[model samples]
Target: MIRADIDPKVGGHFLVIDRRPTGDAVHYGVFLELRRPRRMVFCFSAAEHDHNADRIQIDIEPLAEGTRLTLSHEMCSEWGQFEEQTRQGWVHVMQGLERELDAMQVVSVPEIVAQVAGEPSKASAP
Candidate 1:
């Protein structure tokens, strides 16, 4: 099973907390990436199972106030069978990500404006 935790914080940053289990093994990784409200790109990889898995790339574009997120997994041969499952798995995760991003809009807009105003962002505040 694959599990993921997403926390969309202040500023244009988001955190990806993920864990995956296969047989007797578990893999985990965290991704922090920049987002432009409706657009974003992040780095992601699994060390335990597919050590050679390349970083995943995500792009989200605005669609009627909401966003459409597209995820691409590169260097698939390195992951062997895991590639297929990973692709399918992302479909589900992307859905959740969209929901989270949608919810984050409430805070992200204000944070973005505050940053544009040249003030210290809450994300960077001590």
Candidate 2:
């Protein structure tokens, strides 16, 4: 991402600008839920496709070795043509999250936001 303006509290808003190979992509959304260490739900959409905004839900579960993050994105039917692209985007994002977690050894809202914004998180283990 090129830049990010985020407020992670429930009902808060976020704006993220990503620099892709093709061009710059802008995404913005509002936080719907923020159950720390458990789940988060937010409205997600590109600036151009804001009319078809989708809700993305992330569920975090603890495991013996580590944590498992399950993501569900309920996209609008209007984005059918971009379905594959969207799926790839999610995959790429998850991969990035994994990389960030590996580097920071933590997973939280602030760290996640930092990861997406291409910044190293200052968050430490609690």
Candidate 3:
């Protein structure tokens, strides 16, 4: 993401601008609920298709080994055609998050760009 302006409290707003090969994708949202380290609910919408905003809920659970994160995104029927892409996007985001948490180091945008551009990611290494 090129820019991420977020306020993490309930009712707060957020704007994230991601650099994509096609162009910058803008996503904006409002936090509906927030329970620190446990659960979060938000309204998410893209700049290109804001008519039908989606609701996303994330639940984080404690595990002996690590954390288990469960994310549920309720997309508008209009977005059904892009389900696979949306799923993949979430997978990439979660993988990035896991990497950052595991390494305890920040991952640069350039590295993410390269990964999205088809460079092999460390997760896929032998």
Candidate 4:
């Protein structure tokens, strides 16, 4: 999953690509609409798998400077007994995402600019 666009006020959109356990890309779709730092709704349909699978909705809320994220997946009827496995998969993915965001926060723009400016420019050194 990758953020394609973000409005900050209205919402954001993401481009999601799914790969099977066999290392083959099986699904590609977009998260249509999302409210910035709040809610997101997305649908996935694999060309090689279930074409009519239900959509997934994710909601996020700010909690004491951090964020609380919730995920609701529709169309569990298709998975039968594997529904629990799917839920567990989402939990792992969510944890990974949280860690990624936390790491990103450590790199500020000003620090990046300072680091870049400290490097020797090709044009000239002033």
- The CA lDDT of each predicted structure is 0.43, 0.71, 0.72, 0.49
Better of 2 and 3 by TM-score: 3
TM-score of each: 0.46, 0.78, 0.79, 0.58
Model 1 pairs whose backbones collide = none
In terms of lDDT, the best-performing candidate is 3
lDDT of 2 at 20: 85
Q: What's the true lDDT of residue 40 in model 2?
A: 94
User: For all the candidates, what are their Cα RMSDs to the real structure?
Assistant: 12.5, 10.5, 10.3, 17.5
Per-residue lDDT over 1-126 for candidate 3, one digit per residue giving the tens place of the 0 to 100 score: 899999989989999999999999999999999998788899788853465677787887665555567787777676677777877898789788777765765432222211222221112111
Candidate 2 segments exceeding 4 Å error: 48-51, 105-126
Q: Using lDDT, rank the candidates from best to worst.
A: 3, 2, 4, 1
> What TM-score does candidate 3 reach?
0.79
Tens digit per residue, CA lDDT, model 1, 64-118: 4444455555543445556446556655665565567568776332111101112
For candidate 4, the 10 contiguous residues with the lowest summed lDDT are: 111-120
How well is each residue in 69-120 modelled by candidate 4, as lDDT tens digits?
6666664354445555656666667667656666788622221100111211
* Residue 84 miss distance in model 4 (angstroms): 2.2
